[model samples]
Target: MATAASRSGRRRGGGDDEDDRTAAMRRLRVLSLHLQDPSPSSEAGLAPAACAAAGRRRATGGADAAAALAAYLRGRHRDTQARVFEFFLSRPDLQTPVEMSTAAHRELCFRQLCALVREAGVRPLSLMANDPAEYFAVMEAAGGADISLGVKLGVQYSLWGGSIINLGTKKHRDRFFDRIDNLDYPGCFAMTELHHGSNVQALQTTATFDPVTDEFIINTPNDGAIKWWIGNAALHGKFATVFARLILPLQGKGGDPADMGIHAFIVPIRDLDTNAVLPGIEINDCGHKIGLNGVDNGALRFRSVRIPRDNLLNRFGDVSRDGKYTSSLPTINKRFAATLGELVGGRVGIAYSSVGILKVSVTIAVRYALLRQQFGPPKKPEISVLDYQSHQHKLMPMLASSYAFHFATRYLVDKYSEMKKTNDEDIMADVHVLSSGLKAYITSYTAKSISVCRESCGGHGYAAVNRFGALRNDHDIFQTFEGDNTVLLQQVAGDLLKQYQEKFKGGTLSATWNYLRDSMGTYLSQPNPVTSRWEGEDHLRDPNFQLDAFRYRTSRLLHSVAARLQKHSKTLGGFGAWNRCLNHLLTLAESHIESVILAKFIEAVKRCPDEKTRELLKLVCDLYALDRIWKDIGTYRNVDYVAPNKAKAIHKLADYLSYQVRLVAQELVDAFDLPDLIIRAPIGMQSEAYAQYTQHVGF
Candidate 1:
């Protein structure tokens, strides 16, 4: 065994070698010089004067640029966000408490939600129907204030009320819309059963038509049929948009009823006046969850609950008093698809709200990084943690991702709005696929990124008051609700394969899938040698190059997965092949979503009217694209699409861009326009973070 000094020397490639020691000391001296000034001196490997001039040129336009970028990021709903955020700021009671019991948190969340509706006058239904842009903006603002409050509001308006608005006819809407808007009818969306969550088509709950009584008898056939994880069901919800298999009574006696497939029905779960559980409904608390204790998740079971015939949300399918079921969709599968399609707004809302979470988390982490300083060169002031390359690598890319997701989710919201306005089947289909993909992709990303943010903040982050714990716990369920990320990814994969097959039939592809048509020939071919080897900063920064690389990866994955499935079907059967290729299918779906996000980010950057803001966004876009490319360089290398030298260049460029982004990281996070009131973390304060944090921790 060697002594400690000898071991360290060996680790540095020179055990007891004087020459090596000298070289190492020289290198340290140069590094110290660079760290001391960081203005590109000769020791820092650049001409000081010229680089200093360039640095001045590249300096941020300060608050103006941040405000302009914030405007762009807010899209068409800036006024809504400003108003809502101001309202939240004014209401100190709405601030999330540092400590509370589950019941207390739930009650507080509910009261805050009521205040948003009654005091703030946020008419979610009206906004959704007339101004979806403002609707999402309000949701995003609510989420930024408190994740639980945002989710509870979403369950009330987007899921429960939206089901009535989109799936129900005028009668249903008239009965529920005003009540829901005014909080007179707090409701639950009772869709997910204990045993069959993602597989909605296989739900075991039944709603039998009683023609004689002119009512539908809803029942939970087994424990597995109990509606699980239902928001507001534990206490407040008076009604639910219950989804169950519609069973039509047979014409003759002693005959089995006809199962008319799944349909939505308005079922009363509790007494509105007294807030008591209805006669045939049983509600049980889900107990403590990892996060989001404020949402009051509960299990609901219906035992032969009876409701009038008109309770059925029959926009797509309806049953007559004589027990005749009719639908314009013709088939059970078609009707099921259409009915679920109407609820796509839930997924869109999840995606939008997930971005809100990302913004808040990133804002906290980046702000903390900017404020907290650690080691520095001898005889000099300590440097911010954000100045270190390693720190920048950790937080800057994620910051860029938060920005990327903002525009991506915004695009999803606009597309959803367009689908609603046009009601075109093709647009609806596009929205469905897009919403599912974004919901899964963005939520999962935010969930993981929140943890990174927590760790990036160091020991103080572990403090409950810092909010990482709650943010992580509350956001964890986003990946499972709306739809499980795995199931949703498979859905996206299935849609991609459908598009691939349709492309072969010379069908006109939707805007989202049109790239598949070109992928067959253009993307499947080997890369040109020149393009493969090109590794200049300008080339790597080009949006076209970034998008092309993304498209290539997605297309290649799509093609390979399609071929593999085709080949495996002969031996394994269709379902077996799909199971065997499940991992690959998920990869394909993720790649496709990444491509779409990059395209949207590029489009958003182009649409920026402010020159300074556009420049900043372009830099952010480059960081996002290059960072993703570097992470997936293996895929490009495997396909020979990127040469070895190019890969190395990409790695270097990504690091450099991370540093570049770190320079304006504060401005980027400030562009989120989050008030200190909403952030609520002493460590993430805008000024005097150390003082605030010490005071907060009782130092």
Candidate 2:
């Protein structure tokens, strides 16, 4: 079963008989790497040219590899876009001590971060480091809407707000934006209440209009109704966009406050000159967070407070001079929908943040893989961990995913780019869907990648200095903050269901008709058998079959999700209705992400130009596709793409990936655009570090 007969051809390395076998053979070598013992190779057998080539891919040669990466990036994707992924990275090797010395961690981190931002000209990203001025300028420049600086305003009820948050109109902007920029009135967004966090409709804060004085009396009726967990509220913010029930006299036309629904009111919390709480409002800090301590968080309490009638944020829904609540939309729910839509900015921001986190993680892991040596022989030589199949198995697929998601993020941002300039509602709605789906996928994945990279580093991974802990802390909120990943996935599923409903109503004579006709058979078809099994890429020389298989499974999975969701909706109700709906839609969102990422990654591989790099990555993509399929192997059992021997076959592809990546890790991580300091794991730092350490340790 395991025969190895060389063909009568001039071959540089071994290959399996079939394309899938050859592909799987690649994966096997990659995984076998993890099982190897730790040791340095004193004597190497490969020729100089081959070793040099391998070095470029593996990070065995530092500055030279980085330079080559810069050159490669200048040509790939956008001809002018530099692969500047590593720009935000700081060295991961230092230990974190609570108190710092003159030349401590903080100073070193700031120096590297600012330098990367300045050198890369990525001003939009400087916000992560809390450069207040640049953060807002780019947000406006990007035409973004109400967003947050990841800080909430007010303690006891001082109010929560962020720079990214929207100020209702030119009036609100005139009144507050300048104060924020000057740090005079930093704020918190008071949308969620203790009683209702995700369910905005259920928030208990209230604003009852006092016709006697032409002011709104904002009050926290009880403890359950109090505003809580507001970031930036502890110290910085001076105002909050408070979401409260808008209670109107039954005779008056204000939308029902009890059922009057939630409305955003821009309320001032502290008197600017004194920094003291307003007469009726109280604030308390949420002190010490798991991460993101950079922003102050707090709680809020409001007594019967008075704010002018004009303070109601009513661009979408308004309050008249007499206290009548009138909205541009027909119903309170519709008006509420518009209000909630602004939160989409948070979704987009989180997606963008995920990109930042992943770039750093991959950089560290790949660089380490290239520098860490293990197993084989001091005479014959073991290999860089990059050459181990499992190393690439853990890191490479995620690399491909990063590429894919990057494209999707760019696509979403471009759409937002167009929407903000034109104020297009349709574009905004689509962006809402995209941001929701992407926020869910990217956040969920970045969390996973963090774990992977941590484990990839072994025991040393848990060290706080490496940034894994900090990155994890900063990003953990991503899963629940902007929106819970589970909930966002459900929303995406709902959007997909809505689309299906619209298509259904389009009948036999609309544009929907044409799409149905054009897509035709394949849209209604089953999984492609060749793609399901790994045989298509059994041979090492030709790779189209492997590529095609990846495409085939991705297509099948998406279609399957649609069909399943459509079927389940017919009978489910109540919790089941929501759960079934959510489950099916999550599947749809996952598939969409998978397809987009695979397509983009392949595009990247195609652009590599190096015959070997392309060939090797093609196999890596195969492994990604195969592993993806195997993950749902239980679901696709009836389908051709899901089978057994192929799993074993694909596992071998890991071996090939491990071997190939040894030569490609440098190139791959370089494309990530990380700086050397941030990638400071002894293994990830430089070619000399590995050599120096080995010599120092008497290896």
Per-residue lDDT over 506-533 for candidate 2, one digit per residue giving the tens place of the 0 to 100 score = 6342211122223333545765566555
Where does candidate 1 stray beyond 4 Å? 1-18, 26-60, 251-254
Q: Give per-model TM-scores.
A: 0.94, 0.74
TM-score of 2: 0.74
Could you say which candidate leads in TM-score? 1
Positional deviation of 96 in candidate 2, in angstroms? 9.2
Separately for all candidates shown, the number of backbone clashes (residues 3 or more apart, or on different chains) is: 0, 82
Model 1 is weakest, by summed lDDT over 10 consecutive residues, at: 48-57
